[model samples]
Target chain A: MEFTLEDISDDEISRRRDLYEPLTASVRELVDAVIRTEVDDDSVREAHRLVQAAVETLRAEQIDGSYGVRFSADLQGMPWGNAVIGLRNAIAPPVQTVRDSDGRVTADFTLGAAYEGPSDCVHGGICAMVLDHVLGDAGSADDVPCYTGTISLRFLRPTPLGSLHAEAVIVERDGRKKIVQGSLSDAQGQTVTAEGVFIVPKNWDGPMPRKARRPGEA
Target chain B: MEFTLEDISDDEISRRRDLYEPLTASVRELVDAVIRTEVDDDSVREAHRLVQAAVETLRAEQIDGSYGVRFSADLQGMPWGNAVIGLRNAIAPPVQTVRDSDGRVTADFTLGAAYEGPSDCVHGGICAMVLDHVLGDAGSADDVPCYTGTISLRFLRPTPLGSLHAEAVIVERDGRKKIVQGSLSDAQGQTVTAEGVFIVPKNWDGPMPRKARRPGEA
Candidate 1:
């Protein structure tokens, strides 16, 4: 794992979040609209055209490849391109994990129509995705990057697609390996429970040397 | 599990696939663009407005709830709301599974920037998502709906983004439970391997009765 230090100020990071997070949220809403819209064919065609037009506008200027994990010098991360919690990823439910003083991580979020599998239920794979993110987050430290080695999940019951909660804690640590346990729940209770092994590479250093460029240098 | 018999014809289903699949593909491109765009703030703002406008047009017409699994009288499934393989879901990488005569399921697809978690690697959860879908599809008969009971995944190596492959097969069965094994691989070789137990409900009957309504009646 590597972290590219972009030398961005905290304020610039905040400003970028302010600019991008809402756009991500809006795009997520657009996803729901496309799935559930019962519009006339003409309206659907029009919406598709307009969406593509916006795509063209953005594609006019872009990076060459994937957005790697970038961070400020202080270790504030801009993993906004991440699939599960990326601030700029509309596909993400964007679990906003909060770390406890004791190192437990928790998040409260919701699944919607776009995440459906069975009738009214959150897809089983989605349950695993959220669990993997929260569990991986729980195993991470500011100075180290944690990668998931293995995970086992049990679907105790069908997780409904609505308000949900997730929590993860480091159950054990063995040298460079951490054992994490996590769960995803609805109001009724925990529907999916997970346990995973997270590993910190032996060759780990810290973040990369600060790049002399500012944000948006792509 | 239930299926709404929409009385949709094969010709109509093909036509709708023609209409919506391209739209889904475009929206997916839009997602990648949003992630990698290096446009100026003014351009970003303009893109946002245009995207929201498209959202508004689609929201002008709507459905009351999520799209449940729909099928035709001949049992052609239209699980267009699925997260992993939904035809109309922009978030879905949309695994196109082919069932072999021996009942194995396989898919070859690509994961782009939007699926990244670590640098240039496909997110662990996305791998699980695609695996679950393919494994479940393998476990399912045309007459039975397979639900994931448990899944265990081992990250053999970092799964790189871009072209990839997946395969699943039923290794064993215990009455209503099907034990399935699956794998996700990069060009180099297998990167993630999975084992899952899929359950067919004890009271399984079949698809829901034909609701006398036509397609797009949502």
Candidate 2:
């Protein structure tokens, strides 16, 4: 749980998002293509070469290690390297979430074929993954960064892979520990429910801003 | 819960693995590059264009929708579209697991920058994702395909990025339900422990082959 202070402006962050978000989207598209492509061997081979070339181009000038959690002086977070909701991580469904004035968090997103587990249903682990992020995000505040301490999930039914909805809210809080409750639903109704304990560590100066959790999006 | 009979031979499956495995690896590399690249804006733009070009080339010949679970007549499975262990899914840590004679399942893999959740540690949900796959894989036999019914994880500590090990075994089993326990550990020791209920549904003719689980790989 390390937070690096990045002395960059909001404008710079926005500029970087402009530069990288589309690229992330492009890579995500490539992932889907790679999975479902019925192309002949030569075409697949050529695509691989081009993908390798892209990797080389990006790797030509890069940081030594990871893009860890970075924040501006104002506490605006750039958790763009996150796996579940990272703005720059193509692997993410790029789960965009919103926080209500009442402290509830909600998101409406889609899971494609890439997220499948059984038949046309979403992977149970993926459901847990999204629920973990949503619940953990819901339990955190402006000056406190919450980390998952424990999480339990019950699959009431198989979550279908398509337009899905999720919501989370802090149901109980004991000092630094928050017990959050959440659910994942498809067009029919709720399929999976989750509860988690999110803890804000002691002596922690790291504050992961909730800028991504705008109100209107919900 | 649907499995399509691929009608492909073992040789063809091996050939397909040969074709897509490296491509998947390349895409994984691309994901890491996208995360840590500190290249200038123009270079990033160029990289984006090249990635889009590759996507277009692959899209030129593709399937209609998502790649559902496919298997050959002899029950060799190609769950290459899986998000946790899919050989073709770039989002996956591509966790490769093996089952021992005693029915224990284990894996050793490295998670890179692309799998980060907090700072340097693996995301909680990603941990759940991998464990769900591993535990479910452990409880399942060749004739019976188990699906996750419930999974609970206790984050004993933050799972650090890089080399890690995980193992799972069926602790108990009933007619259609299996109780499996698992853990994820880093160099320091155990960071996360998990327990799950995996259920084999009724009238399930779809047996997800355990071909991916060979004995020696454990």
Judging by lDDT against the true structure, name the best candidate.
2
Give the whole-model CA lDDT for all candidates, comma-separated.
Answer: 0.81, 0.83
lDDT of 1 by residue, B1-218 (tens): 65677777889889888877777788888889899998888888888998899899888988877877788667677888888878888888877787777877889998999998888988888988888777777776333556789999999998998999999888998888889999998888999999999888877776633332111111
How would you class the docking of model 1?
Answer: medium
**In model 2, what lDDT does residue B88 have?**
81
The DockQ value obtained for model 1 is: 0.74
Candidate 2 lDDT score at position A4: 83
lDDT of 1 at A146: 70
Residue-level lDDT tens digits of model 2 in B105-212? 898999989988878889888898888878888877444667788889999988989999999999987888889999999989999999998888787776544663
Query: What's the CA RMSD for each of the models?
Result: 4.3, 3.0
**Interface Cα RMSD per model, in Å?**
0.9, 1.0
Candidate 1 ranges with C-alpha deviation above 4 Å = A141-144, A204-218, B141-144, B205-218
Among residues 3 or more apart in sequence or in different chains, the pairs in candidate 2 whose N, CA or C atoms overlap within 3 Å are A118-B1, A119-B1
